[model samples]
Target: MPSLGTDPHSVRQRVEAMEKVLERMFVIPGINKPVGLDVILDIIPGIGTISAAALGSYIAWEARNLGMSKWQIARMGGNIGFDMLLGLIPWIGAIPDLFFQSNTRNLRIIKRHLDKHHPHTKTIDVQPR
Candidate 1:
Protein backbone atom coordinates (compact mmCIF):
# COMPACT_ATOMS: atom_id res chain seq x y z
CA MET A 1 0.00 0.00 0.00
CA PRO A 2 1.32 3.41 -0.93
CA SER A 3 1.42 6.33 1.50
CA LEU A 4 -1.66 8.59 1.63
CA GLY A 5 0.42 11.71 1.16
CA THR A 6 0.66 11.46 -2.60
CA ASP A 7 -1.44 9.30 -4.90
CA PRO A 8 -4.88 8.98 -3.38
CA HIS A 9 -5.25 12.55 -2.22
CA SER A 10 -3.88 14.01 -5.42
CA VAL A 11 -5.98 11.69 -7.54
CA ARG A 12 -9.06 12.74 -5.62
CA GLN A 13 -8.25 16.39 -6.11
CA ARG A 14 -7.62 15.96 -9.83
CA VAL A 15 -10.74 13.90 -10.35
CA GLU A 16 -12.87 16.39 -8.41
CA ALA A 17 -11.42 19.32 -10.33
CA MET A 18 -12.09 17.60 -13.65
CA GLU A 19 -15.66 16.91 -12.58
CA LYS A 20 -16.16 20.56 -11.62
CA VAL A 21 -14.75 21.75 -14.93
CA LEU A 22 -16.84 19.30 -16.89
CA GLU A 23 -20.12 19.72 -15.07
CA ARG A 24 -20.28 22.90 -12.99
CA MET A 25 -17.84 25.62 -13.94
CA PHE A 26 -20.42 28.41 -13.97
CA VAL A 27 -24.12 29.15 -13.86
CA ILE A 28 -25.99 29.88 -17.06
CA PRO A 29 -27.68 33.26 -17.04
CA GLY A 30 -31.51 33.33 -16.98
CA ILE A 31 -31.66 29.57 -16.44
CA ASN A 32 -29.55 30.00 -13.30
CA LYS A 33 -28.11 26.52 -13.61
CA PRO A 34 -24.51 25.44 -13.63
CA VAL A 35 -22.88 24.50 -16.91
CA GLY A 36 -19.40 23.54 -17.98
CA LEU A 37 -17.24 22.11 -20.74
CA ASP A 38 -19.48 19.08 -21.11
CA VAL A 39 -22.44 21.18 -22.19
CA ILE A 40 -20.27 23.57 -24.14
CA LEU A 41 -18.66 20.72 -26.07
CA ASP A 42 -22.03 19.24 -26.92
CA ILE A 43 -22.63 22.27 -29.07
CA ILE A 44 -19.96 21.18 -31.57
CA PRO A 45 -21.53 18.00 -32.98
CA GLY A 46 -19.35 14.92 -33.70
CA ILE A 47 -16.14 16.32 -32.36
CA GLY A 48 -17.96 17.65 -29.35
CA THR A 49 -19.49 14.33 -28.48
CA ILE A 50 -16.13 12.63 -28.85
CA SER A 51 -14.42 15.25 -26.73
CA ALA A 52 -17.01 14.97 -24.00
CA ALA A 53 -16.77 11.20 -23.94
CA ALA A 54 -12.99 11.35 -23.78
CA LEU A 55 -13.04 13.82 -20.90
CA GLY A 56 -15.59 11.72 -19.08
CA SER A 57 -13.43 8.64 -19.68
CA TYR A 58 -10.47 10.36 -18.04
CA ILE A 59 -12.37 10.36 -14.74
CA ALA A 60 -13.18 6.70 -15.14
CA TRP A 61 -9.54 6.00 -15.92
CA GLU A 62 -8.58 7.73 -12.70
CA ALA A 63 -11.05 5.56 -10.86
CA ARG A 64 -9.42 2.52 -12.38
CA ASN A 65 -6.04 3.75 -11.25
CA LEU A 66 -7.49 4.10 -7.76
CA GLY A 67 -8.23 0.36 -7.92
CA MET A 68 -11.96 0.71 -8.19
CA SER A 69 -13.80 -2.49 -9.08
CA LYS A 70 -14.48 -3.40 -12.67
CA TRP A 71 -18.19 -3.12 -11.96
CA GLN A 72 -17.86 0.45 -10.85
CA ILE A 73 -15.73 1.34 -13.84
CA ALA A 74 -18.22 -0.34 -16.16
CA ARG A 75 -21.02 1.70 -14.68
CA MET A 76 -18.98 4.83 -15.17
CA GLY A 77 -18.29 3.86 -18.77
CA GLY A 78 -21.98 3.19 -19.32
CA ASN A 79 -22.80 6.62 -18.04
CA ILE A 80 -20.32 8.14 -20.49
CA GLY A 81 -21.68 6.04 -23.35
CA PHE A 82 -25.22 7.11 -22.59
CA ASP A 83 -24.11 10.70 -22.45
CA MET A 84 -22.42 10.29 -25.80
CA LEU A 85 -25.60 8.92 -27.32
CA LEU A 86 -27.46 11.88 -25.95
CA GLY A 87 -24.83 14.15 -27.41
CA LEU A 88 -25.49 12.73 -30.87
CA ILE A 89 -28.92 14.32 -30.93
CA PRO A 90 -27.98 17.29 -33.09
CA TRP A 91 -28.87 20.71 -31.70
CA ILE A 92 -30.80 19.28 -28.81
CA GLY A 93 -27.70 17.51 -27.45
CA ALA A 94 -26.63 20.41 -25.28
CA ILE A 95 -30.04 20.44 -23.59
CA PRO A 96 -29.69 16.89 -22.38
CA ASP A 97 -25.98 17.42 -21.67
CA LEU A 98 -27.04 20.18 -19.30
CA PHE A 99 -28.88 17.64 -17.20
CA PHE A 100 -27.17 14.31 -17.89
CA GLN A 101 -23.81 15.04 -16.37
CA SER A 102 -21.79 11.84 -16.73
CA ASN A 103 -18.64 13.38 -15.28
CA THR A 104 -20.54 14.38 -12.18
CA ARG A 105 -21.94 10.88 -11.81
CA ASN A 106 -18.48 9.37 -12.30
CA LEU A 107 -17.10 11.79 -9.72
CA ARG A 108 -19.72 10.64 -7.23
CA ILE A 109 -18.64 7.05 -7.75
CA ILE A 110 -15.00 8.00 -7.25
CA LYS A 111 -15.84 9.95 -4.10
CA ARG A 112 -17.70 7.01 -2.64
CA HIS A 113 -14.78 4.72 -3.34
CA LEU A 114 -12.31 7.17 -1.85
CA ASP A 115 -14.45 7.83 1.17
CA LYS A 116 -14.59 4.14 1.95
CA HIS A 117 -11.09 3.03 1.01
CA HIS A 118 -8.98 6.14 1.55
CA PRO A 119 -10.90 8.07 4.14
CA HIS A 120 -7.90 10.21 4.99
CA THR A 121 -8.12 11.83 1.56
CA LYS A 122 -11.48 13.36 2.28
CA THR A 123 -11.82 17.13 2.59
CA ILE A 124 -14.58 19.63 3.24
CA ASP A 125 -15.67 21.44 0.11
CA VAL A 126 -15.70 25.19 0.59
CA GLN A 127 -17.40 26.98 -2.26
CA PRO A 128 -16.14 30.44 -3.00
CA ARG A 129 -18.63 33.28 -2.68
Candidate 2:
Protein backbone atom coordinates (compact mmCIF):
# COMPACT_ATOMS: atom_id res chain seq x y z
CA MET A 1 0.00 0.00 0.00
CA PRO A 2 1.09 3.55 -0.73
CA SER A 3 1.95 5.82 2.16
CA LEU A 4 0.81 9.35 2.92
CA GLY A 5 3.23 12.21 2.31
CA THR A 6 5.51 13.10 5.19
CA ASP A 7 5.76 16.66 3.88
CA PRO A 8 2.77 18.69 4.95
CA HIS A 9 3.49 21.34 2.35
CA SER A 10 2.89 18.89 -0.45
CA VAL A 11 -0.34 17.71 1.09
CA ARG A 12 -1.47 21.28 1.58
CA GLN A 13 -0.60 22.12 -2.00
CA ARG A 14 -2.47 19.14 -3.34
CA VAL A 15 -5.60 19.67 -1.26
CA GLU A 16 -5.62 23.38 -1.97
CA ALA A 17 -5.38 22.77 -5.69
CA MET A 18 -8.13 20.20 -5.61
CA GLU A 19 -10.45 22.37 -3.51
CA LYS A 20 -9.93 25.13 -6.03
CA VAL A 21 -10.77 22.87 -8.94
CA LEU A 22 -13.68 21.16 -7.23
CA GLU A 23 -15.24 23.91 -5.16
CA ARG A 24 -14.00 27.40 -5.85
CA MET A 25 -13.10 27.60 -9.48
CA PHE A 26 -15.38 30.62 -9.86
CA VAL A 27 -17.74 32.82 -7.90
CA ILE A 28 -21.30 33.84 -8.50
CA PRO A 29 -22.12 37.52 -8.64
CA GLY A 30 -24.23 39.27 -5.96
CA ILE A 31 -24.32 36.24 -3.67
CA ASN A 32 -20.56 35.71 -4.04
CA LYS A 33 -20.83 31.94 -3.79
CA PRO A 34 -18.16 29.64 -5.21
CA VAL A 35 -18.76 27.12 -7.96
CA GLY A 36 -16.53 24.70 -9.81
CA LEU A 37 -16.07 22.18 -12.60
CA ASP A 38 -18.46 19.62 -11.14
CA VAL A 39 -21.45 21.91 -11.52
CA ILE A 40 -20.38 23.03 -14.95
CA LEU A 41 -19.80 19.49 -16.13
CA ASP A 42 -23.36 18.63 -15.09
CA ILE A 43 -24.45 20.31 -18.28
CA ILE A 44 -23.60 17.10 -20.13
CA PRO A 45 -26.32 14.99 -18.47
CA GLY A 46 -25.80 11.24 -17.79
CA ILE A 47 -22.02 11.11 -18.09
CA GLY A 48 -21.39 14.28 -16.12
CA THR A 49 -22.08 12.98 -12.63
CA ILE A 50 -20.04 9.86 -13.30
CA SER A 51 -17.07 11.91 -14.37
CA ALA A 52 -17.52 14.21 -11.41
CA ALA A 53 -17.75 11.30 -8.94
CA ALA A 54 -14.57 9.88 -10.40
CA LEU A 55 -12.85 13.19 -9.84
CA GLY A 56 -14.32 13.57 -6.36
CA SER A 57 -13.13 10.14 -5.27
CA TYR A 58 -9.60 11.49 -5.38
CA ILE A 59 -10.32 13.75 -2.43
CA ALA A 60 -11.78 10.89 -0.39
CA TRP A 61 -8.80 8.73 -1.25
CA GLU A 62 -6.49 11.44 -0.01
CA ALA A 63 -8.44 11.59 3.24
CA ARG A 64 -7.94 7.86 3.58
CA ASN A 65 -4.20 8.24 2.99
CA LEU A 66 -4.04 10.95 5.62
CA GLY A 67 -5.19 8.36 8.17
CA MET A 68 -8.73 9.54 8.71
CA SER A 69 -10.87 6.79 10.24
CA LYS A 70 -12.85 4.63 7.87
CA TRP A 71 -16.08 6.08 9.22
CA GLN A 72 -14.93 9.56 8.37
CA ILE A 73 -13.86 8.48 4.93
CA ALA A 74 -17.16 6.71 4.45
CA ARG A 75 -19.05 9.82 5.44
CA MET A 76 -17.03 11.73 2.89
CA GLY A 77 -17.84 9.05 0.37
CA GLY A 78 -21.51 9.37 1.28
CA ASN A 79 -21.35 13.09 0.69
CA ILE A 80 -19.90 12.52 -2.75
CA GLY A 81 -22.35 9.73 -3.46
CA PHE A 82 -25.30 11.85 -2.44
CA ASP A 83 -24.09 14.65 -4.64
CA MET A 84 -23.75 12.30 -7.59
CA LEU A 85 -27.14 10.74 -7.00
CA LEU A 86 -28.83 14.10 -6.85
CA GLY A 87 -26.89 15.28 -9.87
CA LEU A 88 -28.11 12.32 -11.85
CA ILE A 89 -31.71 13.48 -11.56
CA PRO A 90 -32.95 15.19 -14.71
CA TRP A 91 -33.82 18.81 -13.88
CA ILE A 92 -34.33 19.33 -10.18
CA GLY A 93 -30.87 18.06 -9.39
CA ALA A 94 -29.09 20.67 -11.48
CA ILE A 95 -30.02 23.60 -9.28
CA PRO A 96 -29.02 21.87 -6.05
CA ASP A 97 -25.81 20.49 -7.49
CA LEU A 98 -24.80 24.00 -8.44
CA PHE A 99 -25.09 25.11 -4.86
CA PHE A 100 -24.32 22.06 -2.70
CA GLN A 101 -20.60 21.43 -3.06
CA SER A 102 -19.72 17.99 -1.71
CA ASN A 103 -16.07 18.58 -2.47
CA THR A 104 -15.98 21.61 -0.22
CA ARG A 105 -17.67 19.67 2.56
CA ASN A 106 -15.10 16.90 2.21
CA LEU A 107 -12.31 19.45 2.26
CA ARG A 108 -13.58 20.72 5.59
CA ILE A 109 -13.35 17.21 6.98
CA ILE A 110 -9.78 16.93 5.75
CA LYS A 111 -8.83 20.25 7.26
CA ARG A 112 -10.27 19.36 10.63
CA HIS A 113 -8.44 16.05 10.61
CA LEU A 114 -5.20 17.83 9.83
CA ASP A 115 -5.73 20.36 12.55
CA LYS A 116 -6.46 17.62 15.06
CA HIS A 117 -3.94 14.94 14.18
CA HIS A 118 -1.16 16.85 12.39
CA PRO A 119 -1.20 20.07 14.31
CA HIS A 120 2.41 20.78 13.43
CA THR A 121 1.47 21.11 9.80
CA LYS A 122 -0.11 24.38 8.78
CA THR A 123 -3.67 23.76 7.72
CA ILE A 124 -4.54 24.44 4.11
CA ASP A 125 -6.83 27.47 3.80
CA VAL A 126 -9.20 26.59 1.02
CA GLN A 127 -12.55 27.87 2.23
CA PRO A 128 -15.51 27.76 -0.12
CA ARG A 129 -17.39 30.80 1.03
Candidate 3:
Protein backbone atom coordinates (compact mmCIF):
# COMPACT_ATOMS: atom_id res chain seq x y z
CA MET A 1 0.00 0.00 0.00
CA PRO A 2 1.21 3.47 -0.82
CA SER A 3 0.97 6.54 1.35
CA LEU A 4 -2.03 8.71 0.62
CA GLY A 5 -0.93 12.01 -0.86
CA THR A 6 -2.55 15.47 -0.97
CA ASP A 7 -2.12 16.11 -4.69
CA PRO A 8 -4.98 15.43 -7.10
CA HIS A 9 -2.94 12.96 -9.17
CA SER A 10 -1.94 10.93 -6.17
CA VAL A 11 -5.48 11.11 -4.79
CA ARG A 12 -6.81 9.80 -8.09
CA GLN A 13 -4.37 6.90 -8.04
CA ARG A 14 -5.17 5.99 -4.47
CA VAL A 15 -8.90 6.14 -5.10
CA GLU A 16 -8.58 3.99 -8.23
CA ALA A 17 -6.48 1.44 -6.39
CA MET A 18 -8.90 1.35 -3.50
CA GLU A 19 -11.85 0.92 -5.85
CA LYS A 20 -10.08 -1.96 -7.58
CA VAL A 21 -9.43 -3.69 -4.28
CA LEU A 22 -12.99 -3.20 -3.11
CA GLU A 23 -14.83 -4.09 -6.30
CA ARG A 24 -12.75 -5.94 -8.89
CA MET A 25 -9.84 -7.77 -7.36
CA PHE A 26 -10.57 -11.34 -8.55
CA VAL A 27 -12.64 -13.59 -10.71
CA ILE A 28 -14.60 -16.36 -9.11
CA PRO A 29 -13.64 -19.83 -10.31
CA GLY A 30 -16.03 -21.37 -12.87
CA ILE A 31 -18.56 -18.55 -12.61
CA ASN A 32 -16.50 -15.98 -14.48
CA LYS A 33 -17.59 -13.15 -12.23
CA PRO A 34 -15.20 -10.68 -10.63
CA VAL A 35 -15.15 -10.20 -6.87
CA GLY A 36 -13.32 -8.04 -4.39
CA LEU A 37 -12.98 -7.28 -0.71
CA ASP A 38 -16.44 -5.72 -0.70
CA VAL A 39 -18.15 -8.94 -1.65
CA ILE A 40 -15.74 -11.21 0.21
CA LEU A 41 -16.00 -9.24 3.39
CA ASP A 42 -19.78 -9.48 3.34
CA ILE A 43 -19.49 -13.08 4.41
CA ILE A 44 -18.78 -12.13 8.00
CA PRO A 45 -22.22 -10.82 8.93
CA GLY A 46 -22.30 -7.37 10.59
CA ILE A 47 -18.59 -6.70 10.68
CA GLY A 48 -18.10 -7.47 7.00
CA THR A 49 -20.80 -5.13 5.81
CA ILE A 50 -19.62 -2.30 8.06
CA SER A 51 -16.00 -2.81 7.16
CA ALA A 52 -16.79 -2.71 3.47
CA ALA A 53 -18.88 0.42 3.92
CA ALA A 54 -16.05 2.09 5.77
CA LEU A 55 -13.69 1.36 2.92
CA GLY A 56 -16.25 2.62 0.43
CA SER A 57 -16.73 5.77 2.49
CA TYR A 58 -13.01 6.43 2.32
CA ILE A 59 -13.37 6.95 -1.43
CA ALA A 60 -16.08 9.51 -0.87
CA TRP A 61 -13.82 11.23 1.62
CA GLU A 62 -11.11 11.40 -1.02
CA ALA A 63 -13.60 12.96 -3.42
CA ARG A 64 -14.41 15.56 -0.79
CA ASN A 65 -10.72 16.34 -0.55
CA LEU A 66 -10.67 16.82 -4.32
CA GLY A 67 -13.34 19.51 -3.90
CA MET A 68 -16.16 17.57 -5.51
CA SER A 69 -19.63 19.06 -5.27
CA LYS A 70 -22.01 18.07 -2.53
CA TRP A 71 -24.35 16.42 -5.02
CA GLN A 72 -21.64 14.11 -6.26
CA ILE A 73 -20.51 13.28 -2.76
CA ALA A 74 -24.08 12.59 -1.70
CA ARG A 75 -24.62 10.28 -4.62
CA MET A 76 -21.47 8.44 -3.70
CA GLY A 77 -22.70 8.18 -0.15
CA GLY A 78 -26.06 6.89 -1.37
CA ASN A 79 -24.33 4.20 -3.38
CA ILE A 80 -22.35 3.06 -0.38
CA GLY A 81 -25.38 3.24 1.90
CA PHE A 82 -27.47 1.14 -0.45
CA ASP A 83 -24.72 -1.41 -0.84
CA MET A 84 -24.12 -1.51 2.87
CA LEU A 85 -27.80 -1.96 3.61
CA LEU A 86 -28.05 -4.79 1.11
CA GLY A 87 -24.96 -6.40 2.56
CA LEU A 88 -26.54 -6.39 6.01
CA ILE A 89 -29.11 -8.98 4.94
CA PRO A 90 -27.41 -12.13 6.21
CA TRP A 91 -26.75 -15.02 3.77
CA ILE A 92 -28.70 -13.42 0.94
CA GLY A 93 -26.90 -10.05 1.20
CA ALA A 94 -23.78 -11.27 -0.54
CA ILE A 95 -25.80 -12.18 -3.60
CA PRO A 96 -27.01 -8.62 -4.18
CA ASP A 97 -23.78 -7.18 -2.89
CA LEU A 98 -21.98 -8.90 -5.75
CA PHE A 99 -23.97 -6.96 -8.33
CA PHE A 100 -24.15 -3.52 -6.74
CA GLN A 101 -20.61 -2.24 -7.16
CA SER A 102 -20.72 0.91 -5.04
CA ASN A 103 -17.00 1.45 -5.10
CA THR A 104 -16.87 1.23 -8.88
CA ARG A 105 -19.70 3.73 -9.19
CA ASN A 106 -18.02 6.01 -6.73
CA LEU A 107 -14.79 5.69 -8.68
CA ARG A 108 -16.55 6.80 -11.82
CA ILE A 109 -17.85 9.86 -10.02
CA ILE A 110 -14.40 10.72 -8.70
CA LYS A 111 -12.82 10.25 -12.11
CA ARG A 112 -15.28 12.63 -13.68
CA HIS A 113 -14.55 15.21 -11.03
CA LEU A 114 -10.81 14.86 -11.47
CA ASP A 115 -11.04 14.94 -15.25
CA LYS A 116 -13.07 18.10 -15.21
CA HIS A 117 -11.20 19.99 -12.51
CA HIS A 118 -7.71 18.54 -12.64
CA PRO A 119 -7.26 17.53 -16.25
CA HIS A 120 -3.55 16.86 -16.00
CA THR A 121 -4.18 13.93 -13.74
CA LYS A 122 -6.19 12.14 -16.38
CA THR A 123 -4.69 8.82 -17.44
CA ILE A 124 -5.13 6.58 -20.42
CA ASP A 125 -5.83 2.91 -20.03
CA VAL A 126 -3.64 0.75 -22.23
CA GLN A 127 -4.48 -2.87 -22.79
CA PRO A 128 -1.62 -5.33 -22.31
CA ARG A 129 -0.85 -7.76 -25.07
- Maximum-lDDT candidate: 3
On residues 35-68, what C-alpha lDDT tens digit does candidate 2 reach at each position? 8888877766889888888899998888887788
lDDT of each: 0.89, 0.80, 0.91
1 against 3, candidate with superior lDDT:
3
lDDT (tens digit, per residue) of candidate 1 on 1-129: 223344899899888888988999999888888899998999998999899899989999889989999999999999999999999987798998888899989998999999999999998977654
Please, what's the RMSD in Å of model 3?
Answer: 1.8
Q: What would the per-residue lDDT of candidate 3 be over residues 1-129, giving only the tens digit for each residue?
A: 645679999998899899889988988888877799999899889999999999999999999988899999999999999999999998789999888899999999999888889999999966332
- In model 2, where is the ten-residue run with the lowest total lDDT? 1-10
**Which pairs of residues collide in model 3?**
none
TM-score (all chains, Cα) for each model: 0.91, 0.85, 0.93
Q: What is the lDDT of residue 69 in candidate 3?
A: 92
Which runs in model 2 stand beyond 4 Å of their true positions?
Answer: 1-6, 124-129
Listed per candidate, the RMSD to the true structure in angstroms reads: 3.6, 3.8, 1.8
lDDT of 2: 0.80
How many times do residue backbones clash in model 1?
0
